[model samples]
Target: MPPHIRIYDVTQNISSMLPVYPGDPGFSREVLKSLEWGDPYTLSALHLSAHAGTHIDAPSHFIRGGRSVHEIPIERLIMMVDLIDSGTVVSPENLSGLNPLAEGVIFRTGSLTGYLSEGAARACVDRRLKLIGTDALSVDSSEEDAVHRLLLSNDMLILEGLYLEGVPAGVHTLLCMPLKIEGAEASPVRAILAPAEWHQWIL
Candidate 1:
C-alpha cells in the first residue's frame, strides 16, 4: 500500500535449466493443455523440490519435532533485513557489524561459497536473529550440517538460494513468504527487497 523508489526481485527463476541442489529434483513443467495447441485455455503442472530456487527452510528441516513451514507466522517472514557483503566466507568477524534493528540478515557472497562457519552461525544466534538468508544453497560447507542444526534448533529460520548479485548492501524491507503447505519442511518463495524506508508504510 506504499510507494517504493526501487524494488529488487531476489527470487531465482524456476525452470528446467535452473540449477538445483545436488540429488534434488530439477524443476519441470508439463503442459496438459495449451492455447498454442488449440486448447480452450492454458493449463500446466509444475514439479520441483520444495527447496528448489529461492526458498525458506523451516526448523523441521533439521531439528526433530521442530516447527514446519505452515506453522511459521506470516509476520516472521516479512521484516526489516540487513544485507551484508561477506565475500566467500561468512565468519563471526565479518558479521560483527550486523544491524541491531534488523530482524533478518541476508549474506551476499559474490560466489556460491557454502561457507557459513560455525562461529558465524553462533554469532547470529547471539544476536537472536529471526532469519538468516544466503545466496548459497546450503549454509554449511561441510556435510555434517552443523550450521543448519545450530540455527534451526535455536528456532531461527533459514532462507537459501537468494539472488543478490546486484542488490545493494544495507537495510531493506524483506518480503519473502513461503508456501503454506502443511507439514512441509521447506517451500519455494518469491523473495523481494525494497528500500528500508518503506517499512513505515507496512502495517
Candidate 2:
C-alpha cells in the first residue's frame, strides 16, 4: 500500500437501487435468516446478473469460446489507468495524445451521456489497451454488439456501471477485481483508484 496515496471508490453500490441495462435482471436480496426471526446469525441471499452494478465483462461475453471471468489474469485487473472525461460520446478524437502505454483507460462521461462509439472502441483496440472502463451502463448502448466484439476480440476487458461523478480526469492506479466465477461470462467488481504510484504495490 502507498501510505501517501488517497483511494477513491469508483464502484457503484450493489443494491436494489443500482441501475442495470434494460432487460437485464436488477439486484435483489432475500433475507434467508434474520436476527428478528430469532436466528443465531443473519444471512441473506443475493440475486443479480453477473453484469450488474460495477462489473467486468469477460471476452466470453461476446465472443464464442473466449476467456471467462476466472480465466482473466489478476494482473490485468489492476493496472496503470488513464481516466478521461469524454462528455457524451467517447470518440477517436477524444483519445488523441493520451499515453498509449496505459494498461487501462476509464471514461467518466456522466451516466446519461457516457458511451463509446464503435470508432472509439476500435481506436482503443488499435492502442492495444488491456482494459476499458466507463461510468455508463454499457460501452455502446446503440451498437453494443459491434463495440463489444471489437474490443473483446482483442482480449480487452470491459468494465461498466462505475460511479465516477466526482473523479477527475488523469492517470491513476486502478484496482478492480471481479468475482472468480468459473466459466462465467462476467462478474461484479469493487473498483477503486489511487495515485499512480500505487501501481507498484498492486501485485
Candidate 3:
C-alpha cells in the first residue's frame, strides 16, 4: 500500500509570553473570562512584535523605500518548495540536488541558528534560486551583510527563523502565510509542507 498523506508543519510555536528582539515586546496573552471563571466564554488579548519568531521580512525590513508586508502581493505567500538539507554551509553544488520547480527555497543547515558565509550564498545563487528561506536568524554573513544585499537586491523574499528539523527534501507544496499587518516591515508566519498532489498542483 502507498504511504498515507502527511502534513509537515514548518512553523514555530507561538509564545504568549516569550523573548523578542532587542527593545521589542514579546507576545503576551490575557484571558478576560472563561467558563471556569463563571463567565459566558473565554476572551483574550495579545501583544507581540510584528517581526517576531518564524517571520517573513518584507523588502522594507532593510530598504527604507520598499513595500511593506501588507503591500506585497499575496501570490508570493504560496509556492512549490524544496527543503534543501545543506548539512552545514550550503555549498554551490548542493543547488543541483534541488528540484528546479522550487522557486521558493527553504534551506536547512542541520542545527545552524545564525547567518551564512559569503561562499555559501554565492554557491546558492549560482544554482538560480530566486526566493530564499532559512531555518536560522538570517541567511547571510552578519559581519559584512554582503549575502543579505546580494539576495535581497535580486528581489528575493527572505523567510527567517524557521524550525525545519525533520522535513524531507523533495518536491512539496508550501503555504507560508504571514500576518496582514499594514506598514509593518515583516510578520510571523505559519509555514507548512504537504504533498504536491494533496494541493492538486504539480511541483
- What is the lDDT of every predicted structure here? 0.90, 0.88, 0.72
Q: Which parts of model 2 have CA positions greater than 4 angstroms off?
A: 1-4
Candidate 1 at 57: error in angstroms? 0.1
Task: Residues 1-203, candidate 1: write the lDDT tens digits.
Answer: 86537899999998898878778889999999999999999999999999999999999999999999999988888889999999778989877788878998999876665568899999999999999999988888845689999999999999999998788899999999888999999999999999886676884
List the candidates ranked by lDDT, beginning with the highest. 1, 2, 3
Give lDDT tens digits, candidate 2, residues 1-203. 84565689998889898888888999999999999999999999999999999999999999999999999988898899999888888999889957765788998787643789989898999889999999888898753578888999999999998888777788999989899999999999999988887888766
- Top model by lDDT, which number? 1
RMSD of each: 2.0, 1.9, 3.0
The alpha-carbon lDDT assigned to residue 31 of candidate 1 equals 96
| Model 3's TM-score against the true structure | 0.81
Measured against the true structure, the TM-scores of the candidates, in listed sequence, are: 0.95, 0.95, 0.81
Predict model 3's lDDT versus the native.
0.72
Q: For residues 17-94, what per-residue lDDT tens digits would candidate 3 score against the true structure? A: 443444567777788888888999898887777767788877777776777788877767777778877765655666
Candidate 2 has a TM-score of 0.95
Could you tell me which residue pairs clash in candidate 1? Answer: none
